[model samples]
Target: MTTVKVKLTHKNYDVKIEKGLHQAIGEQVRSVWQPRKVVLITDSNVGPLYLSSAQGQLEKAGFEVLPVEVPAGEASKSLTKVGEIISQMAQAGFTRQDGVISLGGGMVGDLSGVVASLYMRGIAFIQIATSLTAQVDSSVGGKTAVNLGETKNIAGTFYQPDLVLVDSDYLDTLTDRDLVEGYGEVAKTSALEGQDFFNFTGKIRSVQDIRDHAPELSERSIAYKAKVVMGDEKEAGQRQFLNFGHTFGHAIELLSHGSLRHGEAVAIGMVTVTRVFEAEGISPEGLTQALIDRLQAVGLPISSDLVGTPLFFQHMINDKKNRGGVINMVALAQVGQPIIVPKPLDEIRSMI
Candidate 1:
């Protein structure tokens, strides 16, 4: 078991990553806070698979357990669902001392984190991430949010989790496509960090590689994010580098009308941004092609199926990252380096 500590301004926590670490959750929480009433928030798909085991463990530790399950999907990350979960927490007789445990993927982590953040002002929460995307990225940063309509993650807060428990065993139940979707983020992180990390992902040839090698990969991704979050916890500075491909990625997800997974769209977005950088004569030697090959090997799409420069440009304008009518983009000068460039719509349009 490897442990990484995230020290934020208002709070500090530890991210514990290992295979079969779920059983130790009760003991871990006890070490942080005295055993109090606990709430386990999960989605329908994950509820049957791992929820009961978590509940049983907490109950055995002498704490009352409340399990709340929402429908599984991106659609669940909404204001309405947030209200529903808050109401459920109240009905369960929760207190300020109780903590909420997010027991699924990113969706569960985001929504439940928000619930824990807002309930009775704020309560502690733990991330028991069961998916690759959540374990490596979403579960660590303290960025909790719900999607407002078509705009992704527009309504949210910076609520850090008290503990992040990742068990690679859960990846065994993930579909090939799901695993591929996660590799996109892992690849993007590798690209933003450097050749050593990028090359590590390049050698992966199967889903089992992701599971077998997750601890190291998870640690690397978490470490990269931790530095950014620690420096600019509020995203007012260098932290924006973490959104390397998300600007175009979020636009693509919006344009697809919710069909594309976040990481899949990000894969296409990274390729699009790199091509734009290449056209501008700013990309590094052999980097673009290598990144593209790595993404393809993991089954991520290199190009968008929907083609229309005008439509794509329109979607990019609506990104939350845009500031004062100018689109702020995080573009790569080379692997492991990201520079934020503000571009006019006409210039961005011409590239499409």
Candidate 2:
């Protein structure tokens, strides 16, 4: 078991990475935020597998657990779904004194966190990430959002969780494709962080390796994220490093008509960023090749199907990170060092 404490200005939380830690939820919640009621928000796919265990634990802690299961996939992150879940909480007599527990993957965490943030202004929430992507990245961050049409995360808020509980055992039930999708983010982090983290992930060749290793890889990735986030909690400075591959990734996801998974699009986005870096004479030694190789090794796409530079540039302009009509892209100066370049629309169009 490994623990990383994330200290926010208002409150501090712990990200507990361990195997079979799901069973300790009752005690952990009691020790941290003691609430009379807990609304466990999960997706349809994950509800059947682990919902009972979480509910039982909360029940044992004398909590009135209201299990709300939404349909799985990205589509669930919508205003309609969020409203439905809030209504469920209302019918269950939920109040600010109560807390919400997200027990699936990124979709659950993001959607549930939004509910926790908006319901009665704000309330406590816990993250029980069941997927590699959520455990490593999305679940730890305070950013929670839902999509609005073609734009990604257009409706959202910064709502931090009270606790982040990562259980590696859930990876056992993940499909190979989902596991591969997760590696895209892990590889992107490697590109931004350094080769040592890349080397650490190289040992993870298969889903079994991820599960068998338990909290080691998960804890390390979370720690890397925490370090970056602590320095720039609002993404005002060095924290933008986390978006190394996300600019192009988010566009690809929008352009693909939701055909590509977030991680898969990010994999393609990382490749595009590398190409742009090379064209700009800013390519790092062996970095581009290594990233390409690692992405391929993880079954992620190295290139995108969309080829029109004009359309791509248009999407980049609408990016949330854009400031004063200039897109701020996070590019690699070297492994472990990221440079934020304020790119003009014309320059960005030419690069695409």
Candidate 3:
């Protein structure tokens, strides 16, 4: 097992990564938590596969486990769902002394973490990130959220988890689309980390390639992210680089009305933004094509049909990065050097 400790000013936690770690869920939680009631929050898709084993493990470890399964997908990341889960926990007589066990991918982790934070002013929660995206990105950052209207993660908080257990075994059951969707984050991180990491990810051409490299991939991304989050937990500064591909990506995603996955949209966002910046002489001339090639190598989309359209930029107007009518767009001077430039909304619109 490999462990990455996220040392934060407010708190510190460990992200344990290993295959077959799923079997140790109960024992692992027990090591960090006392015997108490826990709401095992999962989604419809993941519940049938791993919830019982996870619940049984927690139960065996002396936790009074109450299983709450929500319908799976992006729609589940909503205030309505958050309210429903909170109501369920309240009805179950849950308290801050209790905890939450998020069992699934990014959506489940995000939704579960939001509920745990809101319940009784906050409670302990652990993330068992099952998907490639969650394991590498969302699970480690302590950023929890739900979507409001068409915006992605517009509603969220930085509520750190007690622990994070990433077991790659659960990824075996994912569809090829689901598996490839995760590489979007891997690709985004590779870009932020620079040439070597970008070259490393460029070699990933198939699902088998991702599986072969999952451990190292998860470790490297999480490690880099932990370092970044430790320095800027609230996205006040350098941490904004992590949103390299997110601005345009989030807009394209909303425009698609959930047709595109988050990472898929990000893949497009990375390419789109880099091109716009390159055209404006902000990024290196060849950066966009390089991103296109690498992202395409992993079967990820590099451009969205909705892009360059009015609605696409319209969606971005609501981006969290907007301040005083200017968008703090993350641009790359090169593969390794990302900078945030506050561009006017009208200037961004000119790219279309």
Candidate 4:
């Protein structure tokens, strides 16, 4: 088992990563949180697979568990779902002392975190990140959110979890497409982490390679994020690097409707935005192609027809990362060096 500690100004927590760690969820939770009634949130797809075992473990560890299941997918990340979960917790007689345990993937983790943050103002929550995306990116860093309408992660908060447990064993059941979606985020992180990690990720040409290096990938991604979060928790400065592909990615993601997964859109965003900056001579010549090679090596898409359209132009202007009237896009001077470049709305439209 490897533990990464996230130290913040108001709170600090540990992200624990290991194989088969799912089997010991109860003991791990008991070690950190006092005994209390906990709400275990899962989804349709994952409930049948591991919900019973997770509930049993938590029960054995002396926690009173209420298993709440929701539909599985991106659509579940909404205010309507958040309201329903909060209503369930209220009916169960939960308080700030009691906590929430997210037992599924990123959707469950993000949804549960938002619930925990809003319940009685705020309560404790544990992240048992099951999916690759959850384990690598969303489960750490304390950014809890739900998509508002078509805008992704529009309603959210920076609520840190009490503890995070990432079990790679849970990823074994994921579909090939799901693994590819997650590799998008992994590739993004590796690109921002510099040459050593990027080179390591460049060798991963298949899903089997990801399965082989799950623990190492999870550990390194969490460790790098912990370092960045410690320096800038609220995204006022350095933390924005984590949004390497997100600015334009979020725009294209909205435009893609349901066809594109978040990581897939981010894969496209990284390459597309890099291409624009490269043409402007801001980013180096090879940066865009490098991203394309690394992303395609893992079967992640690097471009989309939806990009450069009128709708795409409007969406980019409305991105949450933009401040005032300036559209801020994350650009790489090279691997490991990310910069935020602001552009005029007309300038952005011209690029499209």
Best by lDDT: 3
Total clashes in model 2, counting residue pairs 3 or more apart in sequence or in different chains: 0
Would you estimate the TM-scores of all the predictions?
Answer: 0.96, 0.95, 0.98, 0.97
Model 3 compared with the native: what TM-score? 0.98
Give candidate 4 misplaced runs (Cα > 4 Å): none
Q: Name the lDDT value of residue 225 in candidate 1.
A: 84
**lDDT for each residue of candidate 1 in 1-352, tens digit (9 for 90 to 100):** 8888888888888888788787787787777867888889999989999889889888888778889999999899999998998888899888898988899998999999999999999998889998889988999888998988767888999888888888888888888787778878899899888879988989986767877898888889988888788889998978888888888888787778767888899998888888888778788766668878888876788888653456676776667777766887888887887888888767777776
Greater lDDT among 1 and 4 belongs to 4
Error of 1 at 286 (Å): 2.8
Number of clashing pairs per prediction, in order:
0, 0, 0, 0
lDDT of each: 0.84, 0.84, 0.90, 0.88
Superposed Cα RMSD, model 2: 1.6
lDDT of 2: 0.84
In the range 95-198, model 2's lDDT, one tens digit per residue, is 98999999999889999999999999998999999988898899987999998766779899988898999988888899877877877888778767777888
Candidate 3: residue 129 lDDT (0-100): 94
In candidate 3, the residue pairs with backbone N, CA or C atoms under 3 Å apart (3 or more residues apart, or in different chains) clash, namely none
